[model samples]
Target: MDKKPNHRLAAHMKEAGASNKGLARRVCEVAARHGEQRGTTHVSVQRWLDGGGIQPQTAAFVAEALSDKLHRTITPTDLGFPGPVPVTPTAGVNYAKSLPEALSVLDGLARLRPEDDPPSELLLTEADVDHAALTWLVSRPDGLSNDSAGSRRVGMRDIAAIRTAAGYFMQLDFQFGGGHAHKAFRHYFREEVLPLLDASYSAKVGTALFGAATEISQLLAWTAYDSGNHTLADRYMMSTLRLTQVVDDRMMGARILANMSHQANYLRQASRAMRLARAAIEGGRAHSTPRGMALFAAHEARALSTVGDHTGAGRAMNEAERFFELADTGDDPEWLSYMDEAELVGEFCHCFRDLGKSREAVHFAERAVSLTDPKYARTLGFCRMVLAQSQLLNGELEAAVTTAGLAVEAGDALQSARFQRYVTDFQHAVSVHASNSTVQQFNEQVRDAMTQMDDE
Candidate 1:
């Protein structure tokens, strides 16, 4: 069968009065601004118009460019691409509406097979984050009727089992890496947790079940992100946010938004990161404990630093410190108990490093490394890598090489892509000093460790 040409894109292009060349040029310009260097041209646009769909990242840039040119929100769906349709002004952002719609989205996502190819369209964007933020700010507690037609009955024991499984998976992620545990977590969710949602229960039990599932979903998102499956991570997070809204758990919703902010900053979408972090603060303001507030503020600080807003970053950092000082763990959720002084300091290290304050970065990184628990091996390795980078920036080559060696040794035990990235970055930084005996030794150690990982 022949693939049909995308009439929707042809019509939109005609309506916008944009030639193929002009559209391609606009897309390239927009993509460059977003830090994506694409060699898109009129030929590419022609192919897409002829029904050869573009990559998801390019589709996002094209949509933004056309939206700007046409003064409308153009989306990949409007171009007849596969995957979820883009939310319009008339349609709510994905997973931000009522319970049934959210559940439907979740069911569809859960049923989807793991594709070797990238998704056909990019559903999540900066605009989606902004809209979600707005929805969270004005969201109310809408009760979900738990009177299911399913025959199986769910009770507190099932919910307890789910919580225990979440905790166990979370520990694996913390001790090793998300890559080691994300698949297991998803498998458990599909096999053990999904049925509970389908089983019969009262409204109270339903709410509890959703809340538990929401936490698991959040963990799944975190693990997906850690393992470098960013689009999948976004989908999991969207489900988690919807579940939190369904349960009226604003604190968890806020944390999810903050997680989105962190991922955006990591991806270099500074504006989007700042917006999401601010939204997180707004969403959690009434219900979050001081510890949770501090965590949100720390995320905001990192986003501000990424955007070159030094003053704003500093203020947010101070706020985080103040909130942390006032925090009582008893008032915080169990999931948030990990956000202590060590975590705050680690965030401070990241903010200062991004801001080019090597001294500050080294100070906080060292503190974080000392304060972090051994159980958090991945975090400890990351902090050590940060410290090594800061040392290099400060012209302490000997200290830098030694600390980097320690970082590599620590990271060798973990399966985290993030840890590997950090090691790679450290290697790149030390390449200029490769002639040094210490640096050469460090490189050899890294190569051996990488080989060991591959062997395992």
Candidate 2:
């Protein structure tokens, strides 16, 4: 059967104020910047607008072009495509050999919409991660020569400003969750940081600039992941890893791998998670501080637990603890200063919970809650909810109700969808005991919190 032409593409074309020839020109330009050669013309665009399908690569480029023109995310699906669109391999996954190539991928991702990029394109496979890790393992630092001529000159002040902005965004993300600041951070990176990368700098200044930009890119990825935009998160993480490699920062690369491991586990890609975590350990063994090693091991433990490898998880958890005990806060990277005993205990809570050891889960959850700082509002809420789940599962209904109430209180101050899911999951768990007064009260509190979220 001949398929009908899609009207959505026409509508979006009109919305973007782009004619056939204009859209074709924009797509070719965008594709060329990403190192893809395209021979798209006005006729190709007209065929698309007339309800004929284009090649997957062209479809992706057209979507990017429209997204740029419209200043919002546009997806192939949004254009009424029949199925997942194929993406260029080098779009965000290429491990660039030079700083400029790395920066190009980062800039490309900042402008892309998550839905426009499919999971197959954005998410890393086990083999892909292994190759990346191996590349990092063998790669030497590039000669730090900044001899290129450019219009504007970058300096220490610009680097400091970027670092300061990143720190402020990090604080906001911790307090209110990533959903609150994800868009603003993306805008800041695209509008503020991208321009500086194009400016001239001394080799020393360029190295520092890359370092600062790498950290900010990592933060952007974390916020995007926490905000529930996994596809976007994957793109950002890959870009960050590329930048880390360009700067030859082994510790930062390990952290990025651990993050990829965590995200893989979150998406239920357990075997891939295990591979990535092990890669982090392998790549970081010689260079990382004790605290950094512990972070990587803890991530490995979580991945092991997810796949029901209780013994492996236990060993990894113990290893994480041993390393954490040796950690000196003053000796660690400033980026890793956040990982401590409390964070390790929180990982244990998750590990035990996944292993179905409710009592152990509750014990560590309580300890984590006590040791966690109050400033981490979202983490506190999530930890409390984990405690509540353990309490309920252990048949301590009253305590569960109390603990769940506290989680709701903490969550009320945040705007995170992931946190809301945590609350909602707890609510579902307690609904069987709805007739009890405490359960009833917890339910009411949850209702109130959700209503407040809606109002806000």
Candidate 3:
């Protein structure tokens, strides 16, 4: 209990001409509209002003009743009803309506959103994702400024350093997986990248700064996705999209949308994944390069495959391949340097594997595994697992066991929770052969690999 009288409520009641009994009746009426019933009375109103207790839900109705009477929004706080526990806003989800708001939202992500327990409020919702993507599609680019008040001079060199750090982090993610280097990643982001948001820069430098921030922010989201923190990753991607809008980075904004598509598909929300992918394709059309379009199309194919749409998946995959073939023109962003031929085909491996096209799945998976550079432990790990799945589907149990063992070896060198999931998937697929000793050995290998990696 607050143990303090709510004097503000008395003043608002007079201004709204709400008598105690009349307001009590109105509160009951308001609650009924929302399918809630309340037994409020004039005596309850007096008790409330005398520091007596009230149900939180009933308190809301009282506020709403006054709002209706006064024809103005009336929150409980304005009526001196400050509850003991504060209500924290869900941070890092909104697609900011302006540049300054985006920066503030990003700041709150690290501050207001507690890392412990996560609670139910920290969970991601499909409605939030839909709103973000829709806003990005319709909202005009912001008129950004270089006249931030802090007066700390930001230069091209700082942006270059950030760009370099982003590249390094991407490399680390590709090599050691997302579980590695997050401490260093957040340290650099908080200490180095964030301060630049308020620093002064020339118009050109400001554009470059936001562009560099876009890459780093996307990396932040990607790492979270790989580490299996879907809620956190979704927020990071939302922030990235807002940054892209501020800078009018059509291609980059679309890339963030594609990342959302990938994450949605990963979480088995195939329909929403398809929606995000199409949104990316539509949003990126004006400025995206062949490589960028390839990625968006690949995500579409992935979603289609997951939904059992073989024809649609194949068509989208063809578009991805055609765009990728044209990607040698060098019009892609520095951030997309990773979506090479191998990565494009790796998308095919994922699509075909999901569609149960064993031959094609194996064909693309082996090529992707071989073509992926040795240092890309995560990608290699992914390709090997897909190959194992294809082999298992083709009834090549012995080869499947061998290739899955190889994937487990790669998983040993990676720290991704998603990699661990892939291992689990392969184990489940081969578990039907639980009576077989070789399959059992492979399952044991997977267990050992997961034990060695970051179990978070």
TM-scores of all predicted structures: 0.77, 0.76, 0.78
The most accurate candidate by TM-score is 3
Best by lDDT: 3
> Across residues 116-220, which tens digit of lDDT does each residue of candidate 2 receive?
435554456566667776787788876454543343578999998998898888889889988787778877887677666655689889888888888789988
Model 3, span 360-452: residue lDDT tens: 999999999989987778898899999989999988999999998988875686878788888888888888899999988887876676666
Compare candidates 1 and 3 on TM-score and give the better one: 3
C-alpha RMSD (angstroms) for model 1:
15.0
Worst 10 residues of 1 by lDDT: 84-93
Q: Is 2 or 3 the stronger prediction by TM-score?
A: 3
Model 3 misplaced stretches (Cα beyond 4 Å): 1-89, 111-122, 454-456
Candidate 2 deviates by what RMSD? 11.0
Q: After superposition, how far is residue 17 of candidate 2 from its true place, in Å?
A: 31
- Model 1, residue 70: distance off in Å is 52
**Model 2 segments beyond 4 Å from truth?**
1-90, 93-98, 112-122, 434-437
